[model samples]
Target: MTDSSPLDDNAFSHIMADPALAGSACSLAVACSGGPDSMALAFLLSRWCRDNGRRLTALVVDHRLRQESAREAETVGARLAALGVRVAILVREGPKLTRDLQNQARLARYGLMLSWCREQGAGDLFLGHHLDDQAETFLLRLARGSGVDGLSAMSPIEMRGGIRLVRPLLDIPKTRLVATLEQAGQAFVQDPSNLSDHFTRNRLRRLMPTLAEEGMDARRLADTAKHLSRARQSLEFYTSQHLNRSGRLYPHGFVRLERATFLEAPEEIRLRSLSKLVSALGGADYPPRFDRLQRLMKRLEADADGAGTLSGCQLLVRGGRIWLAREPSAVSGPVPLEGVGSFIWDRRFRIMLSATKKWPKETDFFIGALGIDGWRQWQNSGREISGFSILPAFVRRGIPALWRGDKLVCPLSTQKSDHWQDHGIEEIHLIAGELFGKTAFSSLNMRTM
Candidate 1:
């Protein structure tokens, strides 16, 4: 590849077109730092996006770990602004960084950037992960004994939340990025952490030269990863087929697994299916660890009726089938109604709380799960559920309930639409989490390798 392909307008256009991502979004949001690689990307994208009539938003996340971080972000923003690109500095607000600083910093960076992209209605997000990063990731996942997906390293495009995260320079070498900066007479900051021996990645980078001398170069590794990525895509196709047939999706935020048919599938397919389900309901990025997942699979394979909890979700086997539900303790906490309108509670339910009064105050009501105490109140109200006893128990603690004072108000089970039940106005609907449909299994798409 030519040196300009990493940042040239024609190259950028080709990358977007070849990947079929040009039509996926109308605007581009780039995660940029003042580093050589990201600055090169920002410089290229700024011109490319403008030429294509696409708006560009560059986000600089100040992780706030070091005192100099804010200054760095400001400098980066100023430089990008000079290039006629819109820049936003997002300061990560979190507790003091201690252990696992790299992981924490990463999560903060992506979380802030992705949130900003979503808020701006930006459908495409770009990052500056190069071929070197891909090679390091392959080594890391190889060391961890990861499956094909892990060994696949990074994809050209990944769908996160509602955004398509694009990596345009993944095939470009780091030297090229620096050369691009040099050619443009642009300056970039060098993070001190990169040279630190304390970080695993730094250690790995130090080892790469020796490994390359032994004939394990970055291109060879990245090529291997690309091959594995294709194989991984094949497995995903079958996995999707299995998911569609293995379980009955319920509109009430749960699923009914046809246990026998699920167990009949091959081991790999079975594992993948279960992992996707747990991740979807648990609202976690990755499934449980391999050991934990294996143990759960063993129990399920025995075909014995039983129940267990893992990854913040409950799996109960009854009458030769499985019922999957979210653990109440794991769901989101109380979200204040604020007023009368539709709002998502814990991402598990879309609650519509209409007030009986024409106007409602902020202190008027709160929404949360119906725990044991709420259950007692529900029983004392002289009510009984006549059907689907197991279903009610599954969501009882987590069923959205609106309360003004000590009164039970309206829980998911209550049919009465009056008094506190009305939430001061109209009826209350306790919708399930899966009502909007569970997203595809992208949790394992971590850049571990």
Candidate 2:
């Protein structure tokens, strides 16, 4: 490997020593775009992996938005192959391109890349984002008047989609990457879109030289991001502690929060906690807007005894506690429970059905949300569950139940048998793992370079 390469032996050594690669060394996938930055990364990583006895794979995502994408991917593959690195190209397939091209492209790119890494059993996915990109991101967020979390910009390591995503070159500059490629006599593709003003990133990039002359260089902006990132980390730590002490997650995509304790926390922690709850219970990809969340938090803490929905989740203030549940509209499914077995219903609750040996009869059932008629019939049955009346109808309707042709088989958790010992469907484990698993915001996991 060339000593002048952006990611030289010393750079790679430093990255390897960090927490990003703390675990036992395994296979890794490096995302490359055939650009100067990514190519330089691939070159250095290939040599490092070889010397360290670790396997490295070069992954390229071809957007296919351009006519030359296929050819470009092939060229990149051949170049990496010459360096003794295995290459895999995933093309963006299906659907005609539309508006919001940049955002859509990024989502598609990451989604595909993460899926590939999981399928390949790669330990970590390395990205080529560097100081220049981090600087641009910071400025873009700054122009939008973003908060400290946004200004912190990109992180050196992130846990996304159950994969470890590491950006080892964040401290290096774009010029260094270009210089590395030049010194090695390697060819790199330059996408014309980088010069187009239609994209905000491109517009900001065009002004970078002018800003640098005025003392707003990438190094300075990136340093600011690091400072804000440190602050964000501190907030994240407290946010986690606050949630654990004040809020408790419940089964079937619900959370039980101690209202008094939640409202007493600092405003930022309060907002962050509420955002975490809504996103987790709602199964929302992104949290609600900050201002909306701020208003909603105030209303919930002070006056929102009424029913309302935010981030596709239903909010109910019951007595002195705040209950967050998935909006019935957000969850729907009538999965057939084949015999005595456990099954996931509505992507929110895991329901298990079982019959005792004393029963000795096969039970057929269909699992679904307890509908309006089911709730009414259940009420008329004179089975008074304590505190059930305080629940909103929408929240009650989402309770999973088993049906056998107009017959109510147990509402949510239990299906009791005639004999106490022979409890039919003994213990339905109503699990809400997915909702609670990602309660913490992703930004919290971000570690700045």
Candidate 3:
């Protein structure tokens, strides 16, 4: 192989010279896993720091999945320390093997790394993902039939979890990194799990080369990812502007432009707008699929009396106006209120006891669950409370009882009294439904959730 050490130095200098990296006095924290790619990154950053008079730190995260992870972390730390770079080792302790566990571990790894960087006064975290990783990601997303945002793959730089993540080595090839490590006599730990066919990423990496024989290459794939990223960014910008201009917020929900506004924009822009609105209200986790979004949008235009639900929010077409409402909790059972305790009636409604001393007088709703002593006292005073008392049979069977003042109120299913209604009891804000229509919901769900 060509002398990889010189090539590593050249690549490092090139990245530092990039306009994106210039003018930031931010200290750099290289995420070193002791893998060849990360080791190469550590070496490059160390050299760059010495030349540019910038501070560099190597962060080694031990996921502790393997028996040797702690050893590996120490070995990597020593290697970086030998290069005159400060080293910080982070150990992540967690569950094993399962997909969910792996994801949780990944999150913990980044969280710990970023937290350490923040504590050390570092502003940027440098990752060591190379062009091959990007290309593999794009192919995997494409295979899943993801939309523009998914196809965009990993970004060169992204702000995540309050830390700026910069992939300075994305343009370089993994082979080149390995070669550099070999030339530098770097002893990097190889994670055997990477070669396991059981992982989807590994499967994709294995297949990419065979598929590349049909004229695919990392450079071209990376370029496609870059293009998709730009397109996704532009669409997001347009959607935000459209919502700000035409969206109206109500006490319980918000409405985007009337049907006319959606019909005016191009299909892509309209879909993007709808996705944004749904995401804003439902939280990022709620995203409806594309076909569902398209069907909902068509229904809005063609079926004047149509209504649909997506992402746990409901969309209603009434008399020319579109209304989005949160779905009421589906739990139909009654909850017996007893003294002060936290009760989750439906999966949605949660009630807890607050001190009467601190209770606000102007509160909209109050449901009382008093013990016998309190009930007898209120009863002697002749307090007027609404609703029937818990059935004697239910009380006998230890079924939950609801009480208002001294009187027994209806079961948990009963609606609160008018006095409670006037206090902001009846209206609950549901996340806004997709008003930009079906396509937007679909695209947003694919990438975000």
Enumerate clash totals for all models, in the order shown: 7, 0, 8
Q: Which of 1 and 3 is ahead in TM-score?
A: 1
Q: Candidate 2: worst 10 consecutive residues by lDDT? A: 440-449
lDDT of 1 by residue, 95-174 (tens): 87898999888888888887777556677888899889999999988988898989999998775543568888888888
Q: Between the candidate structures 2 and 3, which one is better when assessed by lDDT? A: 2
Clashes in predicted model 1? 7
* Candidates 1 and 2 compared by lDDT, better number: 2
TM-score sort, best first? 1, 2, 3
TM-score per prediction, in order, is 0.76, 0.70, 0.57
Return the candidate ranking by lDDT, descending: 2, 1, 3
Q: What TM-score does model 1 achieve against the real structure? A: 0.76
Output the lDDT of residue 225, model 1: 99
Give one digit per residue, the lDDT tens place, for model 2 in 410-434. 4664333342223334555433323
Candidate 3 residue 446 Cα shift, in angstroms, is 32
> Which candidate number has the best TM-score?
1
